[model samples]
Target: MLYKNSICFISFFFLFFFMLINFFFMMFFIMENMVLFLEWEIISFNSMNIVMSILLDWMSLVFMMFVFLISSSVIYYSKSYMLNELNLSRFIILVLLFVFSMILLIISPNMISIFLGWDGLGLVSYCLIIYYQNIKSYNAGMLTALSNRIGDVMILMLISWMMNYGSWNYIFYMEFMKNDYSMKFIGVLVILAAMTKSAQIPFSSWLPAAMAAPTPVSALVHSSTLVTAGIYLLIRFNNLLIDMLALKLLLLLSGLTMFMAGICANYEYDLKKIIALSTLSQLGLMMSILSMGFGDLAFFHLLTHAMFKALLFMCAGMIIHMMNDIQDIRLMGGLSINIPLTSLCLNFSNLSLCGIPFLSGFYSKDVILEMVSMSSLNIMMYYLYYISTGLTVFYTMRLFMYLMISDFNLLSVYNLYDEDYIMIKSMLLLLFMSLISGSFLSWMIFSYPYMIFLSLNMKLMVVYISLLGGMLGLLVSLMNVYSMNKFLMSYNLSFFLTFMWFMPNLSTYVLNYNFLIYGQNLVKFLDMGWGEIYKSQGLFNILKYYSIIYSLYQLNNFKIYLFSFILWMMILLLMLIL
Candidate 1:
C-alpha cells in the first residue's frame, strides 16, 4: 500500500513538474536567442565519445508542447475514469514514462538518444497495452511488440550501416551524405523502419490489436505518439528519402492502405474499432504525402489528425467509461440527447476528420492531393489517391452518425451524463483548437508560394467526387437500420469482404519481399549442374518463399574445411570437368 501511494505521489510530482518545465521553457524560448542547455554525466567506452544535446528547436518545441498538452490532459482525464481502479499507480507511472520518451525522441540531436527514447516509448506502450493482464490484451501486446521489434531492427541496421561507412552522428550523417550512395541505402532502410512503425498497410494489424489497451492509451497510440513515429522519422531524413524509388513505393503503399482501411472502418460496428481503422487511414494519407516528397504537407496533416483523433478518442473514452465499457456502435443510439457536449465535440471532430471545407483536415489533406496532382506520378497512382480521400469521408461520417445519433433503439443501463470536469475541459480545449485554429497551424507550416503549374482537373475532379461520395454515405446512414441492412445484404460483396481481410496481410507480404515491384527486379536460381534440382519458377511469390534456400546454397562449403583432402580433390575434379 505504501509503495502504491508513493508511486502515485511521485507521478503527481512529475506531472506537475513536466507542465511547469514546459511553460517555463516555452516562455523562455519566446524571449531568448539561444536555447538553454545543460550538461549531464555521461557513459563512455574505449575512445568513443557521446555528447548529449539538450536543446530545443522550432520542430522539437512544437512536438514537445503537443506531448505535454495532450499527456497532461490525459492524466487529468484518467483521474475520474480510473478512480476505482486498483492499479492506478502503475498506470500513472507508465503514462509518465511515455511522456518522457516522446519528449526525448523529438528533441534529441543524436541517433543514440533518439533510439533510447524510441525503445522506451515502445516498451511503455507495450506495457500499457497489456495492463489489463487479460488473455486478449496480453496477446495483442505480444503481437504489437513483435511488430515494433521488426521496425526497431530496421532502424538499428540503418544506424549500424551508417556507423560502418562514416561517423554515426546526426550532423555528420547529413554532411557525409552529400556525395555518397550509402545515404540512399540508409534512407531506404530508414523508410522501411518508418513504415513498420507508422503501421502502414502490411504492418497495420498491430494497431487494431492495440485497441485492447485502455481508451486513453488507444488515443495516444493512434493519434499523436507511437504510430506517428514513422512520419517523424521520414521528415527527419527527408533530404535523403526524397526523389527515391523507395519513397515512391512508400507513397503507393500508404495510399492503398488508406483506401483499404477506410473500407474496413466502414464494415466495422465497434466504435473503437471504427476510430482505430480511421486512424490507419489518416496516417496512410500522411505517409502518402511523405512518399510524394511533400514533407510539409504530410507534417501538416499529421498535426491536424492528431488533434481531432485525440479528441474523438477521449470522447469515446468518456462514453465507454460512463456506459460500463461497451464499444459497439450498434448498441449505441440517441447519445446526442444524453451527452450533448460530448456529441457536439464528436461531430465537430468527425467533420474535421472527414475533411469538410474550412476544417483542419481539409486544409492539410488538400495540400497533399494538390501536390500529388502536380507531380509526375502516373495516372493510376493519382487515381488511387483520389479514391482514398473519398473513402476517408465515408468511414468518418459513418462512425459519427452511427455513434452519435443512430436509430438502433438500444437501451442503456448506465449513466451517460456524468460530465467529469477535467475530462470535459480537456475535450473542450481540443474541440476549440480543432474547430477554430488547426487550419491556421497548417497555413503556417505549409505556406508555399503559388507556382504556375498546369491545372490538374483530374485530381480536382477526384476530390470533389470523393467528397460527394462521402456525403452520399452520410445520407445513406440517415436511412433506417432496415434499409442499411437491406443494402448490405443486396450488395453480397464477397470480394470487398475478402479484400478487407486480405489487404493488411498483403501489405505485410510486400514488406517482407522488400516491396519489390514486378518488372523491376527478378530472382534467379541455378543448381551447380545438379540436373535442375528445382524448377526456376519465375513467379515472385515462389522465389521469395525460397530466399532461405537460395542463401544456404550460396555458402562456400569448401572454405569450411580446406584440409579435407578428399573433399578438396573432388571439388578440383568437378571444377576441371565443368
Candidate 2:
C-alpha cells in the first residue's frame, strides 16, 4: 500500500512537470519556428564522441508529453488493478524504468545515445512481460526479447555505418545522406529495425504474446511506449528514407500487416489479445503512411492512437478484473448494464478505433486515407489500405457487440460492479483525452492544413469503406446468434479470417519448429558425433596410447631391458661398419 501510494504520487508529480514543459514548448514553437537543440558532451575520444542531446521541437515535445501522460495514467490505474499483489513495488519500479527509457529515446539525436534507450526498452520490457513468473509469461518474454534484439542488432550496425560520417548525430546528417549511395544500406537497416520494434508483419507474433503481461503494462508498453519506439525512430529518420527502395517494400509489408491484424482481431476471443491485435493493426497503419512520405501523418496517428488505445486497454483491464481474470469475450456480454461507465469508455475507444468521425482516430485515419487515395500508389497497395480500413471497423463493431449489446453469457448470481474509484478515475482522464486529442493535435501541429485536392469519391473514400465495414460487422454479429446451426458450424472462410490467415501458427510453430529441429540435429553432430571423436574421444585415445608406450619403455625388467639395449647397439654398429 505504501509503495503504491508512493508510485501514484510520483507519477502525478511527473505528469504535472511534463505538462508544464509541454505548454512552454508549445508557446515557444508558436513564437519561433525553430528547434531547440541542447547537448552536453558525455565522452569524447579521437574521432569517436558520445554526447547526450535533446531535440526540443514540436514533435518531440508533443510526443514526450503524451508519453509522460500515459505513463502517469497507467501508474495510477495500477494502484487499483495491482493493489492485491505483494510485489507491487517491483512492478512500479519496472514501469518507471520503462517510461524513462522511452523519454531517453524521445530526446536523443545521436545514434549512440539512442542505443542506450533502445536497448533499455528491450531489456526492461522483457522483465515486465515476465513479471507474472509463469511459463506463459516466460515464453512471451523470450519471444518479445528475442524479437526486439533483432532491431537492437540492426541499430548497432547502423551506428557503425553512421560512424563513417565522422559523427553519430543522425539529425544533422540525414538530409546530406539522402542521396548518398553508401547510406542506402543504413536506410534499409533502419527500416528493418523499425519493423522489428513496431511489430510489422514478420515480427508481429510477439505483440499478442506480450498480452501475458498485466493490463497496465499492456496499456503502457504495448499500446503506447515500447512498440511506438520504432515508429518514432523512423519519424526522426524519415528524411533519409523518403526515396529509398526499402520504403516501397515497407509500404507493401505494412499494408499487409494492417489487413492481417484486423482479420485476426475479429477472430480473437481473449479481450486483451483483441486489443493487442488492434495495436498491431494501428502500428501497421502508421508504418504504411510513413512509407508513403507522409511521416507527419503517421506521427499524428501514432499520438492519437496512443490516447485511445491506452484507454481501450484500461477498460479491458476493468472487465478482466471484474470477471475474475477471465479474458474470453464469448463469456462476456451485457457489461453495459453492470459496469456502465467502463462500458461507455470501451465503446468510445472502440468507435474511435473504427475511425468514427470527429473522434481521435478519425482525424488522423481519415486524413491518412485521403492522402493515400491522392497518391500515385499501385492498385494492389490501394486495395490493401482500403480493405484494412474496412476490416478495422468490422472487428471493432464485432467486439462492441460481443461485450456490450449481446446478452450476458456468464453464470448468474455474481457481482459485476464499476465502483473501483481509482481505476475509474485513471480511465476518465484518458477518456477525456480520447475525445479531444485528435482535433487538438491537428490544430496544434498543422499550421497550414493538408492540401487534399481530390474528386468527390476520393474525398469520401474513408467514409465509404467505414460504412461498408460497419454493415458487414453488424451482419457478422447478427449471424453469431440467428444463423442456422449447420451453416454456422461450417465456417471455413470465417476460420481463415479469424486465425489471421494462420500467421500466429506460422510464426510460433512453423518458423520456430524448423529452426529448433535443425538446431537439435546440429547439436547431435557436434556434441555426440564428429566433434566428440575429434575434440574429446580422439584426443583421449591418442594420449592413452602415448602413455602406454612411455610406461612400457620405463619398465624395469632386466632381460627385456638388456635385449632392447643390445638390439639398439647392434643397429648402431652395423650402420657404422656399412
TM-score of every model versus the real structure: 0.79, 0.87
- With a 3 Å backbone cut-off (N, CA, C), the pairs that clash in candidate 1 are 202-507, 202-508
Residue pairs in clash, model 2? none
Question: What C-alpha lDDT do the candidate models reach, one value each?
Answer: 0.75, 0.88
lDDT (C-alpha) at residue 551 in model 1: 72
> How do the residues 1-578 of candidate 2 rate in per-residue lDDT, one tens digit apiece?
77668876787677768877886886687668878899887899998756678888888888888988888889889988988998888888899899889988988888887999999999999999999999999999999998899999999999998878988888887786678876889999999999999999788889999998999999998767999999999998898888788899999999999989988887778989888888999999999999999889999999999999999999999999999899998899999999999999999999999888899999999899988888999999999999989989998888888998898888887799989999999899999999999999898888887888999988888889889999888888878543643465568777776676766687667768888998899889997889999999999999999999878878887887898899999999999999
Model 1 clash count equals 2
Candidate RMSDs in order: 13.7, 5.8
TM-score of predicted structure 1: 0.79
